[model samples]
Target: MKAVCTVLIACVTMFLVPTAVAQDARRITPEQIDRLVKPYLDAKRINAISIGVIDGDVSLTHHLGTLSRDIPNPPTDQTIYEIGSISKVFTSLLLASEIEAGNLKLTSTVGELLPDVSKANPALNSVQLVQLATHTSGLPRMPANLDLSNVTDPYATYSRESLHTYLSSIDPAAKPGEKSEYSNLAVGLLGDVLAMRSGDDYDVLIRRVIAEPLGMTDTGAMLDPSCLSDSQKSRLAPPHDANLDANYNWHFASLAGAGSVFSTTSDMLRFAAASLDPPDNDLGKAMRLSQQKHAAPIGSGVAMGLGWHFARDKQTLWHNGQTGGYHTMLMVNPKLNAAVVVLCNTAMGDVDALAGQFIQTIAGMNVEPKSFDEALTVPAETVARLAGQYEIAPGAVLTVRADQSQLFAQLTGQPEVQIFAISETKWKYRVVEATIEFELPDSGPASSLTLFQSGMKVPGKRK
Candidate 1:
């Protein structure tokens, strides 16, 4: 079975590297970076990792690990990785650009842009463009009608017709603009509407609206091999699952706006620089507008601004994304005039925490890493008793299983990882700073499991 671990364990342990010499925060040496990253790579057994940082006048990019275990080629700054939901930021940029040009407005309804959609469901008339961008349109996280035959590439078969059908039949759990929820469907719809207004497909719209303006030549929804030099193509990092097995790249016919862009660390750094200090161009103006606070999707601490999420305390604007085989993070602190981009080819590494630590380090802040205790002895029978599937959400499930003396967990569409027992009923994931506690009723088998992570308690009932 594939070992899935948390991003925290992989990212924090690296920052906790002990050093006798006091290192200069302003000028971090490449050797220091390698020392911090190499151990995490070794522990997780990850393939390739590329990190880029922009701190004031100091800009640095480093590539570590091999492209794949089979091929010992090291990745470079030009290595392309699928930057899933980070595409939302680009789609919102398009919205801002159109709004600036008087072509569209945030108040513009989905029905207004796509007349055929209104004909099918008049309810769509109430769903505004801003709602889609902010994830306040009351849309579900995904279409319930999605085909699960190919779990690895879930969105490959989802077409324009499928989106319309799902939208027409959806009974939103909350009213439009009533609550803040993350929705890939909502943002995908926003991209489609923007494309319709621009008289271009999602890919072309992004190139013209955001990529071309910023000179991010290599960043786009559909990257053509003919357009790239042989050297650049050779640097492209192949996607890998949690098990370190080769995974196929994702394709989206209609939902391409949500998470279909392939880009390099260099291109992303350019994009980050533009976001930090927007130029006088139209795209720059739109980029600034996209960063303005719109709504507090999850009630005021970290608010949503177009596609970006604001960390008020950190004075940072950032977004993270994950594809089937890759995990990525891009963060910028305009206050400090610094930004960090972390890209990993393997799905298992914790690029999120890695980027956070890099940003914090650039800001000259002290970071304290979390430590884990040794697992307590638990009998094989006790672990087996807790092994079962638990329903976390309507369609999301977490499956727990025992492999001889060890226990593991597998989330829907995620890889399985060995979980260490903290007690008979409580366990911890070594990769992340999270805990799972199994509830046993006065009688038979385990009834439920509660997952504690990121200040949320998610309870899943055994099926």
Candidate 2:
């Protein structure tokens, strides 16, 4: 009934990138940008797009389409959006600030800050602050005890006690600093520990130190109706799905560090400005430190720097975030002193590619990032043969079905999405880079399938 980001994959900061190389510096006209972006909106692939670009002394803002299918007004700087994993960048900035204050060290262990958690699970004591900031702490993407009862607003009722309980329940999947795994739990924990030590809640700490000083007033952990003025409340860009259908916004309770931010394009541009040019202040130094390469390569052609994700061979940095109903991307080319911020009211994976193009174009790099949308048409009979329910985990099922000539896939607690058969058994999603490959038994229904997403191979067996 709803086109959601899927229960298990919601709020995961994943990107499908097409590489960019610097050949020459070129600038496209505003008309060109409209031509590049309006097609997606016109095709109904998304509801709205808000992009901000800053280069040296030049700045521009572009808005396309309505805020939602029912809302005919275009978005403005006042329009607020949930920034998803981009929130991690702010959390990590606070981490760097703490280090600058001589309050915490990169080598500081979880046992030192979160003693109670480590006391409960001794193995976690060795996880260092660097590992947490760099996604090398070996923590899972999410807490296993996370409540999904309200999939739309999944994190609303998650208590701090729940987070502690989950932390104390299991040993890390890998040794601290041994491997890199994008963990919402680890970063969220880092924020919590920093807050505990700083004598401020995460939201208040960020506002008082980070956002307030930089004049980014419209940003914080979450948007509470009671805290906003009438004009501000009316400016909210209500969340929506890929179909331009209404969708519920995410709510973060205990793990707000993971992705609870609600900010506007202008506000994000303000943050990006600070990132491009660090001031002679603690927060600025923290920003500069957070942008340096502090760890090995992460994701595709990127490395982790505190919370920021940077290119391996270029002076470029970026991070993308997605929740159930929104997708956002922020990119900065410090060497070129240029940055771009992309905010969307719809939940789809295309924002990464769009943002990449914007920065590459502005930086004068050849601006085409290869997309993973190359799809193939398969026989209707093959689609029908693969139609069945596959159990992805203990209780999670992935249901595949064939309607007419189209094939669709639906996770147990998520909405059904159309899939394109690239081959007899392999299918890909247009809105996301995920794929599914079914194994036929040669006689009847498919026996199993493998899901390929963000470099993780998840298998499912017929139920």
Best by lDDT: 2
lDDT of 1 at 80: 89
Quantify how close model 2 is to the true structure by its C-alpha RMSD in Å: 4.3
Q: lDDT, candidate 1, residue 49?
A: 89
Model 2, range 211-330, lDDT digits (tens) per residue?
899998887777245444566668778888655678887766677777777889889999998899988898898898898888876433247898877653346777777777888888
TM-score of 2: 0.86
Clashes of each: 2, 2
Would you estimate the TM-scores of all the predictions? 0.85, 0.86
What lDDT is obtained when candidate 2 is compared to the true structure?
Answer: 0.75
lDDT per residue (tens digit) for residues 1-463 in model 1: 0111122211211122221223355454466567667655765546898989987788899989888878898788888887777888888888999888888888999888767767778888888898898878888666677664565666667788888887776778878888776677788778876776677888788877778877887777842344345665676688886557887666666777778777899899999999999999788778888888887735422567888877645357777776767778788767677788888887653556667777766766665442335567788777788899999878779899987668988766454667778888998864344679999766578999998765667899999
Predictions in order: lDDT: 0.73, 0.75
Model 2 clash pairs?
A: 25-364, 26-364
